[model samples]
Target chain A: NAGVTQTPKFRVLKTGQSMTLLCAQDMNHEYMYWYRQDPGMGLRLIHYSVGEGTTAKGEVPDGYNVSRLKKQNFLLGLESAAPSQTSVYFCASTALLGATGELFFGEGSRLTVL
Target chain B: AQSVSQHNHHVILSEAASLELGCNYSYGGTVNLFWYVQYPGQHLQLLLKYFSGDPLVKGIKGFEAEFIKSKFSFNLRKPSVQWSDTAEYFCAVNVQDYKLSFGAGTTVTVRA
Candidate 1:
């Protein structure tokens, strides 16, 4: 079973361009999250959803928006990309949050904004 | 505000050598800890996690971590390392309100 899958494995966007990264999961999880991984910065939360149609800001939420209109998909959008927004984005899903259950992650989407 | 810290930015070890990567957290209340490994070009996978009960948790690939509440630390350890162990490891802590804080990560290289 495909636990979590991210679209656009690699992307390059010009400054001021827009794009959306899609995350899909077959685990039927209740929680989904978007995160960015930087060189020495590890992973920082960008946005999250507790369930379908709900989204919340995370640690590093600037320059990004998220939509969780469906139970199995979470979309992260960049309205206007910037050079500083270049990073590897990851999508994750969990059966439950605030619980001990583990989170399953997608391969990741590498974005380079030039 | 809770935060996670991984002291080692990079680590290199010979095959069959013991390994330890330091991870610390700053949270006062109850917390759940996790260690995730990201191979060269793969997704992040959980190595282990700590919720309650046993502080010493064993995970896949012979990796384990001990949660020391007093020191606010959950350190990952492996008895013997191999060339395949080369990867980037991350430590995270889930505090109140269900947000996870991750460390800067540690890169481990095992030379055969």
Candidate 2:
């Protein structure tokens, strides 16, 4: 069904470089989220979009930026790659189901910054 | 701020053994709880969720969780486990913001 797809599954970047991770979903969900997964840190939210053209910060939003110009796509960008930012990033979306919606997640993007 | 905790970092069991994973969340208001499972090299998938009404909720793969409001805990349990059940499990809490606060996760290994 191609529920949620992420581009550039793996990437290696040098410190101070920039890159963007693209998340696309065909489900047409209204809420989209970007999260980074690290060892022992679980999955920490980086950014999220409630709807088209609306973006908000999450728990770990310091080194990341996100935009949701379109409903089906959410873009996460790294302005300046840092070694501490090396982790696996995931994208997720959920349809409006009141307070009990479940998240559908993408495969994830693995990033390594040296 | 809302947060979730998974006490068991790793658990090892043989096939057909019972399973129990502890999960706790810190929030004063009403919340929606969820358990997600991630298989090796796979994305996270919902195992089950608790919204309201019944305190005990059942999920896929014969998994169930009980929501004890007084204890602020939502523990996942299964009567029997298979080798294929080996995966990483995570507990998450949503305080009506649509943003999930996830626990560190517990790794389960089922030996055949």
Among the numbered candidates, top lDDT falls to 2
lDDT of each structure?
0.93, 0.94
Candidate 1 DockQ, CA atoms? 0.75
Q: Give per-residue CA lDDT, model 2, range B32-58, as digits (tens).
A: 899999999999999999999999999
| Residues forming the 10-long window of minimal summed lDDT in candidate 2 chain B | B92-101
Clashes of 1: 0
Ten-residue region with minimum lDDT total, candidate 2 chain A? A94-103
Encode model 1's per-residue lDDT on A1-114: one tens digit a residue.
989999999999999999999999998898999999999999999999999999999999999999999999999999999999999999999987667557799999999999
Q: Is model 2 an incorrect, acceptable, medium or high docking prediction?
A: medium
Error of 2 at B104 (Å): 0.5
Q: Which candidate comes out best when scored by DockQ?
A: 1
